[model samples]
Target: MSIKLGIIGGGVMGEAILSRLIAQQVYRPDQVLVSDPQAQRREVLSQRYGVNVTSDNGVAAKADEVLLLAIKPQVFKAVASDLVSKDGNHSSASETLPMVISILAGVSLTELEAAFEHQPVIRAMPNTPATVGAGITAIAPGKTVTANHIEQAKTLLGAVGEVVEVSESLMDAVTGLSGSGPAYVAVMIEALADGGVAAGLPRAIASKLALSTVWGTAQLLQDKQIHPAQLKDQVTSPGGTTIAGIAELERSGFRSALIEAVQAAYRRSQQLGK
Candidate 1:
């Protein structure tokens, strides 16, 4: 099947996705259309990715087989309103309606369906790490979606990262855990660097080592298929230095703090959706 993709909003997330898809050669440049009101952003994306460009959301939505809504949550209603108006302009009800995949934070499938009049909609949460092609995305499909639509959404999203199918109810939790997870990890890396600096390493080397440690550890944990707890055990000798540090972390309520942070994010996401 010919896949024509239309993307609304060419901000950081939109540009990141387009760059990855272009680099991977998964879809021809001509098959993709990007719409952003900012002329500078449109010009940069057009020059960088060599895709069709437009300032009209309706034009982009109507030109493609699949439409991706990458705008901010605040602007979603406006965009949806425009799409509905375009649909109304068509004389026939049987006119083809593009399947929509939304990456707007806190936007729900129900609201999207309501705005688009019960069209097949998929809501996805993707993280900043997608810029580096190392992101994880979670998707929840609406009731009207078909198997083919689901697969197509997966294929498009998977171009920039690993895509996981999830229940709509868990989407906020997924956002908390993974969508905001990168910043948490980044903060930990910064702290680890500070620790190394206090331990007599130069600031530059400390930062590099701290980041490498996290990267290498994550690679080992994933590649070895070992439980993270088991990996931690492997590094901690009985009653040794690592165990002492672990004790301090537990005493300081590190795990509890992380859990609470995730819960807080989840709650905020839910509130925004409402």
Candidate 2:
């Protein structure tokens, strides 16, 4: 049987995409294939998703129409070397080269094209929230990619959450923001929980409240389509406790700290690409 999708890794993010695609009925389990070096990982993915699994990347490269490159950036070159031959060519077994969508951080489209050689390549940055089918992925296409390729990429990724099309140049910023934003949000939740605990709430209750507040606030913002400042103004009455807390947060440079964190992460992402 011809494979519809080939996944190059079975790690958390890779599994997230695979599971989401299957769960959303984008692709059936038998239509997809996964390649992982670890025997345990291959077995787990096969058992969990009922997809064909292989230790050889070449099998994925040769068999599938579309490939999801979710391997770590550090091992990308080595993995690509295994897929292509010494002559810098893809397998002749497939009439056409596979369209590749890479979720590997800091791997540029140019680098992907160089490795794959004349194949369509898309660079995507998806956050950890994808594990829960709540990720927002930003994708940039290579020169050779067509409209159909972009649509296919979006269709597969959209299963997880939102899909945003961007130029390759802006990918690092996307990486810093959405790709790293979950950690920032997690920190904010922890801080909120800490504040509740300081005010005499039980740790478990505080944590639950903090998590729920964050989740609820996001849902409210998205559902209402209202600006955050508008919501803030609505909740913060004159001389109220909310206003007082807001004032303290402003005085403590909360917004500035988050901005700097993204900037720092962007710089780190750029360095990794080099």
Best by TM-score: 2
lDDT of each: 0.86, 0.89
lDDT of 1 by residue, 33-124 (tens): 89999999888988988898989887787644688888999989888788677763223447787788899988888788787653578999
lDDT of 2 by residue, 183-224 (tens): 999999999999999999999999999999999999999999
Q: Output the lDDT of residue 129, model 2.
A: 91
* Candidate 2 local lDDT, residue 76: 92
Looking at model 1, which ten-residue stretch has the lowest summed lDDT?
86-95
